[model samples]
Target: MPITTEPHVAAKPALTTTVAREYVHRAALSEVLLTGWNKTGRDAFKVTAQWPRSHSFYVSEHGMHDPLLLCETVRQASTLLAHVGYHVPLGNQLSWSRVQFAVNPYALRTEGTPADIQLHVTCSDIRHHRGMPVTMSMHMEAVRRDCLLAVASVRFGSHSPAVYQRLRAGKGDVNEVFAQAPQPPEPVSRSTVGRLRKQDIVLAPTPDRLRWQLRVDTSHPVLFDHALDHVPGMLMLEAIRQAGHAIEPARGGAVMPTSMDVSFNRYVEFDEPCWIEAEPVETAAPSSDGRRTIRVAALQSGLCAVNATAELTDTVSL
Candidate 1:
């Protein structure tokens, strides 16, 4: 995919130890989507960024900013707010409890456009204990050139480093879990996956109509950018997307996801065979525009690892 080399116009001064010391994420991981932030009030912040041609986690094969990246953006922005506004001791890990992504019909592609993006983040709820923020809720939007691209609602819980370490102690080595990369399975049909390329297909249908096996290629430059002990949450989201596409009729058109609500119940182990099962959720009435809702789950050892509900609409009539 092509990438733009133009620098972000609103890029802030390089992060320094003093500024990042209290950040929950460090180094490249700490690079917030926002170039700068202003405290609008006690519970609100105005954050801005010059949309970049590419991002480490946001870029996709189509050269557009993947919808999933907005989740991370909301995450970082939320943490930044907690640290800047509440004086919450930083360096605590945060894990998503619930996430909702609603894509605007006029979402912009970042491949070749230069646009200014702004986020207005408001803290909706904060559960505190012992003078520390234990959980937080935030609502934010990504607007480009006065057009809204997406809006996200997120709830997450903070975990201190010590607590996070203790929780992960028994997880064993992540590298070891990913050491054996499985070969790509037989490619599913383009009509079935809504993807033209085999490499992009994340689901391999099984005899059961509603069940499919998760397919992963560790060498995949984007999906498996680095060795991970468990399946990345983004891949699970992709699986949900693909599963929805497969079950929906193509006569209406290509599937365009409009909204998604996802919850991560547990880590999906890489060494185990993760199964994806999708079901159509009944709607009160048929959508005139060919929109449908799908509920998908990623299961391992018969236990749900992730649960997601996605709303998709046909892009064009066939």
Candidate 2:
């Protein structure tokens, strides 16, 4: 089938990501969709997929489905319609995406069946920012085996032509990239950096320790949707990472997460407000050599949702 690159107002050259080749699996795609697809734009779509249940790309020793990967699936599927109907051209590089909210049932202690997942998504309200057009937001959900796993609203935007070209030429200004873009209507918390919505804080604390909380709101991108009720395993890890960034002292030091060991206790969902608390339990030698250890805990309703230990290293100054 024709990939959804046709019918744009501007005949912008069709482009796809190298990352797509890595993530796209014909067998998985077929198992999820049941029917093969040609890239075509439709008003709505419901595709399915399955998890390996053994091997995994990152965490998940049993090959369980990943929340972030699920988000990627919905994102690609939703944007495929845009590529066919709207004029936004795909670029080789995708920048950091700001997740407005996500709701995953699999994260809520529900068994997942990827091949049986029912993905429902709709695209609308087009607008332009920084010379790039975007679908105001995406409303998406994932269901499988009679259980809803997740629902989320995700925001995506591309760099301006000038920014893209400059970066491509190796002459983009780093300061500009670090500068804050337009702030959202909601105010982020003082303890958080990248973003904050009520109890949820993004990029908070330091690289050594981190924590966050979940709040109830219609704007929550994923967890608010009706599939499953609780946070996913991957999101839990990311929350730790974001929280760690918030705690790490900004004295211009490089710290990157190298490893993590985590365990899930109970479900933390969007049904009500919940919080994540994390802190440093260990650190490496001061010789600037060796890995540093950090401890984290996520709590909901004053109960432990998840706990983890992370390994970090300082390569250089930030």
Best by TM-score: 1
Error of 2 at 224 (Å): 29
Question: Per-residue alpha-carbon lDDT of model 2 for 72-148, expressed as tens digits?
Answer: 45545545534433445654222323343344323423244324455666655547665556435556666666667
Highest lDDT against the true fold, candidate:
1
For candidate 1, write residues 70-177 as lDDT tens digits. 655565577677787776666576677788889874464554654466888888688887888888888887887788888888888877877776876765665766
Error of 1 at 49 (Å): 3.9
Off by over 4 Å in 1: 1-34, 50-66, 79-91, 109-112, 178-187, 225-227, 249-253
Off by over 4 Å in 2: 1-43, 61-64, 85-87, 92-97, 101-114, 128-132, 159-163, 166-318
Backbone steric clashes in candidate 1, count: 0
lDDT, candidates in the order shown: 0.72, 0.45
